[model samples]
Target: MSTPDPGDIEPPRDPRAAFAELSKIMLGEQPLSATLERVAQLAKQTIPGAADVSVTLLQDGEVASAAFTGPLAAQLDRQYEAGFGPCMDAATSGTTITIDDTAHSRRYPDFARAAARKGVRHTMSIGLPVQRQTIGALNLYGTDDVPFDEATQELATAFASYAAVAVANAGVYASTATLAANLQRALESRAVIDQAKGILMARHPGMSADAAFDLLSKQSQLSNRKLRDIAAELVDEVQRGGQD
Candidate 1:
């Protein structure tokens, strides 16, 4: 006699499909920042009561939100600015912190009040532990007063574990790539500098290698350029002169 509204019908929960999608994300070639953003969105989709989701990362003693699904999730920024909240506590302590009712939360009263003002009534932060260290947190916010049940909490924890591994691997890959790039540039700079020094020494018969290097450094300082750049320019000029 009555038709159910499509908006009122809950979407089917397919944990397997969600995990499959996460696995594909891990295998994708996206950068760490994009990967984390997708992870936050995925968490919001996979978790039943998640009104919003955010990923908080702690680096060099600074806490910041790396990714978030909605404005409510971005509220974690206020916690980061204040230096204390469920997200920060979870990340620092490697523990899951839950606020069933933000209006009545005693642990982080200030953040609770702030979140309540934004219509957030429930929140949870799961520590993202990597290599035995807590590097960040996966945070969830809900507008409803009802707390996440034990089953939902367990599912969230499992999803967080998977996301943590992906994040750690991406971090390692990024660091290694940066190191390799730096090493390559260093080697190239050394080669060009050596060539420049040889050219200068050939021009000034008694010029020592150290003296030639000092000349390059002087030019670099005067021009406000890097020593490597100056050396490369000198080498290029010598080659061009020879060709002419």
Candidate 2:
């Protein structure tokens, strides 16, 4: 299949429509990475003079590009391997960092040189703030030396807000799904353990449920296995014997 170009996608000009598009992507069943990729593509399409766009995420105290429009955008983001690039700075400090002319930028000499060598003359990074905390950055690159105008910068900032909301909502949804799955597994394990306990009680007429559980626990410890696994094994063996 051919790769889809960001330029081919219709840009959402209105802020409300842009946010609705982002929300639709986030609310879908796709993974967070895919959603972030779509966000990057949307930003590239919406921002005028933007040659490329990337989403930089600070996960577990490490900064990395979570999504990008193309290889150039991803390469430029990684040029700051020392964790001192505009993208990293924006994400860490929760501020917008712009390099109007990469060749003349003194704030990040190394990154500027690298970006210039990669044909990127101007760049902007807007921090993605979620719930009073900065989680990432939205980075834009331009081949032209001209900096983004004030109005364009404002649009980028607004789009960053939408991206931040998408990230926050996606995180909450993922956490909720994980918790529900864990609870379901816990319930299933309890039911199986209870069945094993009943089997032990049936074998020993005077054994209480507590005693039966203790017996299973002892076997689990001696066998160097999980309590659940031990109970499952015993239950399976009894069922197979009954079938025979």
Those runs of model 2 whose alpha carbons end farther than 4 Å from true positions after fitting are: 1-16, 25-28, 175-244
Off by over 4 Å in 1: 1-13, 26-28, 176-244
**lDDT by residue for model 1 (183-206), tens:** 355446667878998999999999
Predicted model with the maximum TM-score: 1
Model 2 TM-score, 2 decimals = 0.64
TM for every model, in the order presented, reads 0.66, 0.64
Candidate 1, residue 181: the lDDT equals 51
lDDT of every model, 2 decimals? 0.74, 0.76
Clashes of each: 0, 0
lDDT of 2 by residue, 109-130 (tens): 9888877766777889999998
lDDT score, candidate 2:
0.76
